[model samples]
Target: MSFLPYALAAWLFFVGLYGIVTSRHFVHLVICLGVTQSSTYVLLLAIGYRTGKKAPIFTSGVPVKVGAVDPVVQALTLTDIVVGVTVAALLLALVIEIWKRAGTVDPDELRRNRT
Candidate 1:
């Protein structure tokens, strides 16, 4: 049970890498990049997780020194999600432009036309 998250993260990373490697279209490559970024979020959350800790919050009835899950990892993951979305959007836009100019989204065709 404890190892599930790690395994999932690794799987996501590998799948994304495989997709990227075998991708033929620029749009498919952009989507694969997103899959790769999702693995980091899972890994970060897994690393910061506490087995039986409370949320990192102050409450009147709770003990002042009770163990709380670290909030930094959650914060970082949120930031990463925002940045990743922005980057994915930019990449998609670039791919659209490439398709417009090249008349095709195939990577091999684009490379051939670049010469």
Candidate 2:
């Protein structure tokens, strides 16, 4: 049962790779990037979950133990998510600008014009 999520995430990540390989449009590539980003998030969160661990909190009457998921990993995941979003947003913005200036988003066509 624990491996189910991992399997699904792997499958989704492969699909995203396929899209990136076969993409003919810039917008489709951006969508594929989003898909891959989500796949990593699912994988990371699944790996950090514990079967019986309580939430991370140190109350006066309750004690937090050593078996809880690492907060550092969680923080890294959050940072990765933010960075991915920033990259995707910047790429999309560049795509829009390229479309406005060149009137096309095809990478091959852009290369053609570079000559």
Top candidate by TM-score: 1
Regions more than 4 Å wrong, model 2: 65-67, 108-115
State the lDDT of candidate 1 residue by residue for 50-98, as single tens digits: 9888777877996766688878999999999999999999999999898
Q: What's the lDDT for all of these models?
A: 0.90, 0.82
**Candidate 2 lDDT, tens digit per residue, 1-115?**
3898798789889999898888878989998988877888778878887878755565697655656764665776799899998999999999999999999988778889999
Best model number under lDDT = 1
TM per model? Answer: 0.87, 0.81
Worst 10 residues of 1 by lDDT: 62-71
Q: Native-vs-model 2 lDDT?
A: 0.82
Worst 10 residues of 2 by lDDT: 64-73
